[model samples]
Target: MAYSLDGVLVFGLLFVCTCAYFRKVPRLKAWLLSGSGVWGVFYKAAVIGTRLHAAVAISCIVMAFYVLFIK
Candidate 1:
């Protein structure tokens, strides 16, 4: 398997963004969770041959609902 420096950097940035955003803005917590859900499904599809775009999209949709209706 080939090691990807770009992939490592992307994920590293995502992790740092998650940590920093969670600490500064509480509202972004839900949005970050939604984005991470999308990332997880995407990464799983890339690494494990899983097709879960619908699930990831739904997660984002539900989060949108919470942002618009609940929050």
Candidate 2:
């Protein structure tokens, strides 16, 4: 796979998975990270994503590995 934006995206998702696993993101409090507006949208997504970390993480790894091995 090309080490471009796709790589960055995958790495970011994996990072999010790690953060979500440790409950470091999607904070319930109304602070800077979880504030309203654009961050709010992200926070909401993170809330759901963190709850489904297992499925998300597994699928991401599977897809990445599949792409890597296919070439």
Candidate 3:
């Protein structure tokens, strides 16, 4: 199955977020330290107007919180 660009982007973000979680780093830190948060980065990419990134980001964020507080 071929993945669309949006799908690839979302998965890549999720993988990085997961790795960061395991390493105990802040979620989306690379993006935030680069001068934009995940939302801002994805917003700029949203010229295509797909919600995939935002949805995945929110999921990753929630997972990060869960790992930090519960796990």
Candidate 4:
């Protein structure tokens, strides 16, 4: 199939949501939380999730499906 910017955008969004969803998984969490100094701490804080992350992931996945199937 031919690839377009829409495909790339959708893939990029899904990738982000996947990272967000997986940020809490044990090994990934350690890796995701791993960084250095202030950046490390800030990185963990940024990736650590509340339900908002799930919502964002769900919405993005839905959008991804729409883009892939409909658009």
Output the number of the lDDT-best candidate: 2
Task: Please list the Cα RMSD from the true structure of every candidate, rounded to 1 decimal place.
Answer: 16.1, 4.2, 11.0, 4.7
lDDT of each: 0.46, 0.62, 0.49, 0.60
What residue pairs clash in candidate 4, if any at all? none
Over 1-71, each residue of candidate 1 has an lDDT whose tens digit, in order, gives 12565445445444443444453456654444344555554333332222443554465466557547865
* Cα lDDT tens digits for candidate 2, 1-71: 34776677676676556545534634434353453777765565566567887888787887688668953
User: Which is better, 2 or 4, measured by lDDT?
Assistant: 2
Predicted candidate 4 versus true structure: per-residue lDDT over 1-71, tens digit per residue: 12887667565555555665556577876666466775474344345433367766686778768867887
Rank by lDDT, descending? 2, 4, 3, 1
lDDT value, residue 7 of candidate 3: 54
Cα deviation of 19, candidate 2, in Å: 6.6
Residue 6 Cα positional deviation in candidate 1, in Å, after optimal superposition: 27
Worst 10 residues of 2 by lDDT: 25-34
State in Å the error of residue 50, model 1: 7.1
State residue 12's C-alpha deviation in candidate 1, in Å: 13
The deviation in Å at residue 28 for candidate 4 is 1.3
